[model samples]
Target: MLQPRDELPSVLYSAAQVRDLDARLIAAGTAGFELMQRAAQAAWRALRRRWPQSTRVDVLAGSGNNAGDGYLLAALAQKAGWTVRVLAVGDPQRLAGDARLAFEAAQAAGVAVLPWAARTSLQGVLVDALLGTGLSGEVHSPYREAIEAINASRLPVLALDVPSGLCADSGRVLGCAVRAELTVTFIGLKLGLFSGDGPTLVGDLVFDDLRADPAILAGVPVKARRLTAAGLQALPPRQRDAHKGDFGRLLVIGGDSGTGGAALLAAQSALRCGAGLVSAATREVHVGAFLARCPELMVRGLASANQVLPLVEAADVLVVGPGLGQSAWGRSLLSVAASRSDKRQVWDADALNLLAAGVVQAPAGLVLTPHPGEAARLLGCSGAQVQADRPQAALSLAQKFAACVVLKGAGSLIATPEGELALCDHGHPAMAGAGLGDVLAGIIGALLAQGMSAQAAAHLAVWLHARAGERLGSQGRGIAASDLIAPVRELLEEHSPCLD
Candidate 1:
């Protein structure tokens, strides 16, 4: 079993950065082969602990350092009196350096080494040490065939480092990725393991630093960060003399004609998540229902676009486009919201559509929450493009608009204008319903109203919202958007309590 700290590291690194850190450690006095040996021992220990009853193992060894880890692991198993079989998928004749040494050690230990075949028999626990992060293209030829065979084997498997064939930076599959029951990664945690296809493929991931010097890591540049409670800038505890006016007022804009519920949900979420005052600007038809549903909210009927200016002037933060239809009414109101450059704002739904169409422009320092479909429209590319390289797409959106971007989906990514990226890996598939984005927008608005920076508010809000979804998601589907607000509030309090 893994501990809490093993879930993810606070800082994330690219494959190149991790490799550089490895080199740094080697230069710092630890031999490169010594590090490789430590990695093998760590993986061997974890494998044995995870499956203590099994005494027979099969290791799929390729030609890189990753294969070296597998060879050393086979040697360890052989030393432990366990039956060990090494399937040399990569030509062992081409192995060099520490890898060649490991292969020779495995051979000397009496571990049977066989050339990989299409029909290689996998026995006991299977160790996947095939393609490493250096792989840049699709899985081809014998490696692809070997990966397919590994997947075909209905046995428990442990992947060394990242799953073979997974992009170490993007978390995307390269042709095919190995599916493992448990994965033990050495040194730094790759960003790919937390996003895209990573969570499903690398189950129960654990990290071993290979005992690299802490001083060496401090000098390395991190590519991104995984948002966690400890890394956030918390909302301060309220004063004993706190009043409603202490927190900033937020306005929820949208709900054209028949879509009043979206605006109401946004407004309610803002109120629940700690906005001092919440106001809703929606169709005249929904005002009475809004008052009855959330009496604390100051709901106004916006019959004309002109009415939005008054609400805009009163709000400290504006959350736009929750059930906003693309009718003239919505466009008129969005125009008013977009024209102003003074207020902190969050744009979603129809507002995003308008921005994509070039019908409206965002004021400076705004937040954009777009799902893949909306993101494609914004980026002028296919949805597949955004999903294929989510990190790049999110950074592109942030840089293009000079605003904070929350590219929402599996492994939601938060990118800021300064080029910093944060990943939220807490959400569940059951939260994949309508209106969740509306709730998320409102929550973000509430945090901004409370005076969090665009980056801080976005990173924290995404984490809180995803956590709420995860908590309720296990109830098994049909998770309503409203179900998340209360838990989100509770979570926020725990993260940064109101009374300290």
Candidate 2:
């Protein structure tokens, strides 16, 4: 059985792993049918709690364990005096094993099992039990029709375990999927529920372990860990004897020509994130505006990479890319940064492009923050391909570059060379604006300079940056990168801090 938050496991599992656990539990003495029954009861309880006044339920059933849970739930509703109808999309006779047993139980309970029609007048709460985590390909036929009907009906839906047609391994929607108002999942938390299309499809999520044995879960491996402020250990408070150089110096290298704002955003974020000192090595043309906007930042106008060597040597960490172009000047500066093995580096935007062009080698302890397109360039694949499997893509980048990789998209995945992966479930659609990645790069660089490990700083910085975007997303679109500084600062204090 799943425990409370305090007792819950830190790891999350895939759908296949959950199924394997079910098989193990059955082999270990617990009946498979009984587990299916428990799952149905959990879903039923959640449904009733969500809509206590509603006495009607329309359950769309498929031919699998997922549908078995729906049949059992319909039976429970029927027994409880609720008007329940089981719209069987797949042939109920084809149900095998525990699923067939559940179907028989529903029939014995007098639940009306009817064939679904295009005009099925579904009212009250909609229960989606069409497909489970077993889905491998796109949804087909009557099941697709049922999902469309459920979505078109404008009725509130409660998905059992996971929303039908949603790939539990990745949050990708298969052909068509049910968008439920609430999804009650079982056994262990699914990584898909927090990434890719998962957030949009699985409304308010609720997990029910279905009474699986704790020892059974120990055998399965987790794909990733969800990042939360609670998981972060507090940084030791700074002593009263701390001085200016006690923190770290961060150098921002970018701001090619017209896009000086990108470099400025990164520099500002570094300063706000607690870098002891901040400097910008940008195009000579943008120097005036850079200093005027952030006079506190040590601005240096540079025409060549040679001018940046001295600043890079003085800095504890380097944040390169941002508005950097693929021009000769940008390449020179990137080469200079790449040559220095002692300083930590954060590569974003054009810097990532340079690396992808094989213009420079990524040093160890480098953090690569690339949006979907940039990541695609690094992997030599299309952006769509990268977004399709963010976790795998991020891990591949980490392994290839031997650096911490942050693949930015709907469900941003952070992967380290050690095989550790973390997913940030926070952030909002409003963060769809430009320059946010540049800001994120600076945040990570600052954290690294402040003495945090490369991996931890990447995870912490991405989470804080995304969460800040989510906080401001409610204010509507056109969220400027500069707007995130204050909220990110507050979030940093709430998570990690060197001072009280």
Candidate 3:
């Protein structure tokens, strides 16, 4: 098992795969009961650290290994002279393997084991070992009732592995889930805990490898990696003598009538993020206003795709679909942009809608940024279905479109065509406002223009954009999309600078 203080491994695994790894360890001569004991010890340590003054603990357990961990924890608390009670929701006799052994140990330790009832007064720190990663379908009757009671208690909850009723694979709530104050996860980091509803349900997250052999971890395939500042800061330094033209030009192609702000946001972000030159292709009436707002941008007024084609031909990167409508004019401009095979593309907003309509094909070396609704359109599925399994949906988008895909939502996912995945866990709810996606597209476009590979650029852009939102989110509501431009520039300088 990896140590608590060790740097987190880059690899992420699914629940089933992690279970298989546990089985492999057991088969390799380590007993399953010993692993269970280690998990209990880790949870006990985390619980005590989180709530040192609380001497009373209520352990809610089920029949699985998750329940076993709770049973062991209760026993430990009892031995320490703290009042501990074990509420078993499932028949203890039905527990198999390590779980059965844990129950026996709890009984031998003289901890009070009682049949769980909804009316049970759950006091002190509640240990939720009710469900593990093996849960699939909606949480059933008794467990749901128990979970509801636990939530109603408002006591601090310490989850054994994952919060009961949370799908460890997708982060979707199984009917309903227990909101934990702290969650001690064992073996591998489940991708679900960082995405969708996972972040909210899981409080302060803790991971313990339980001293699993390093060689064993190397054999299992990873599902995704969590984006961290250290990894994103690994961007290559710029050459001292490099000229502006070497960075690359970024052309913003959007801003239909009445939505010029979205287009301006993208152009402004690209300019702030170190694009060599920034230009906006928008409604003729908005050109003067956009130019006045940002004199550094090369604002152009175009009425047709024919007029924009020459501009598209001259640019090194294209950021399309900000405020782009599905009208004929928008379709015409998108077709022109899509026809260009040489330039790298960052497609967002209605450009994604246009692609979903079979309006154009996403060429190689392209990035697609889509929120849940847009992702649903791209996948021919409902938004609920997309959120149900965000990671899978993101990977599917990358594979089907053959482009770097950014599935934007609460826990944004960046997926590469090669099946590598990275999660951005830093954004705030204030980012739910309009034009954020457009800004993100421009940020990625700027990185690509600066010669960062599509994968690297997408990863860096997502992290920076999320961190920027987090930095600005505390400033209160109605945060304008343009507000991100300055902070994004600062972050870009901090990560990758033109002068450095």
Candidate 4:
């Protein structure tokens, strides 16, 4: 049986892994049909609780175990006096094993079973069971048509155990995926639910263990983890006797000429994130603006990489590439920063592009923050490719550069050189503006300066950044890059307080 919860579980597994876990549970004495029945009961309870007033259900079932779950759910609804109809998209006669038993049960329960037609009129809540985590590649006919109908119906929908046509391993939509109002998943939480397109289409995710024994699941390693503030153990509070020198020195290099605002945003973010000392090496014209905007920053005008050497040598941590153009000046600054191996580095924006172009190399303690476009360049693939499997792209970047990688977008992911991944399901659509990446770079730099490992810094910075965006996203759009700074600072303090 699945337990009710306000939030999803932290651990995640691929579709194949979840299936294997199911088999393992069955092998461990839990009968396959018993698990299916439990899943149906759990999903039925969840559906009734969520849509209590709706006594009508339209279940779209296939011929697999996914369909079996749906058939059982329909049976439960029918027995409970709900007007339930099981629309068989695939031939019901082809159902075998537990799925066959489920169909028989639904029939015995007197649930209205009908073959789905392209022009089928839908009523009440929609149950999407056309496909499950077993699907990959493009969605084929009838199933595709069914998914389209479910999406186009404009009715509230509940998908059973991973939305039909959604790749459970990558979160990629197979041609098209069902957009459900709620998804009741069984056994293990699918990684796809928190990666790629999963979060957007999954709506509210509910998980049930199906009463799988803890010992049965003890040996399977998780595919990834969902990063949250509650899961992160923040830094210890600052000592009462702490001084300016107790923190860290952070240097930001960018602002080639016209885009000084990007570099400035990074510097401002670093200061706000608690860097003891923050400096900027940008165009001379931008120096006055930096001073006026943040007197705390040690601003220096620089034309070439040589000019930045002095400051780069002095900083404890370096944040490079915000507003850095592809021109020679921007290249020089990155080259100079890349030249040093002594300081930890956070690279973003043009820095990432330049790295992708092979202009500079990432150091040992490097943290690269690249959006889909930049990530595509690094992986030699398209933005769609990067997005289709964000976890793979992020992990590839980390492994390629031997650094921690933050692949930022809807579901931001942080991957380390060792292939460990943490995903942030936070953040808002309002973050689709400029200067945000620069701010994120600075935040990561600040965390690195504060003695956090590159991997830890990237995860913590992403969590804080996304959480801040989510809070501001509720207030409507027009969220500026700088608008995130104070909120992130506040979040950091709330989670990782300065006071003991």
lDDT per prediction? 0.91, 0.88, 0.89, 0.90
Model 3 Cα lDDT, one tens digit per residue, 207-261: 9899999788778888899887777744466687867897799899999999898
Query: What are the models' TM-scores?
Result: 0.98, 0.95, 0.96, 0.98
TM-score of 4: 0.98
* Candidate 3 error regions (>4 Å): 1-7, 233-235, 497-500
Q: How many residue pairs clash (N, CA or C atoms closer than 3 angstroms) in each of the candidate models, in the order given?
A: 0, 0, 2, 1
Question: Tens-digit lDDT track for model 4 on 1-500?
Answer: 22433166788888888989999998888899999999999888888878888989999998899999999999999989999999999899999999999999999999989999999999999999888887867999989999999999999999999899899988999899999989999999988988888988988877889988888787788889998666786777899888767679999999987999999999999999888899999999899999998898999998677888889888999999998899999988888888888889998999989998998777775898999999999989999999989889999989998989999998899998898998888889999999999999999998888888888888899999998998999998999999999999999999898997
Q: Tell me which residue pairs clash in candidate 3.
A: 1-211, 1-212
lDDT of 4: 0.90
Residue 163 in candidate 3 has what lDDT?
A: 95
Q: Write the per-residue lDDT of candidate 2 for residues 247-309, one digit (tens) a residue.
A: 799999999989899999999999998888999999889999988888999999899888998
Q: Best candidate, lDDT-wise?
A: 1
lDDT accuracy of residue 34 in candidate 3: 93
Which residue runs of candidate 1 sit more than 4 Å off their true CA positions? Answer: 5-7
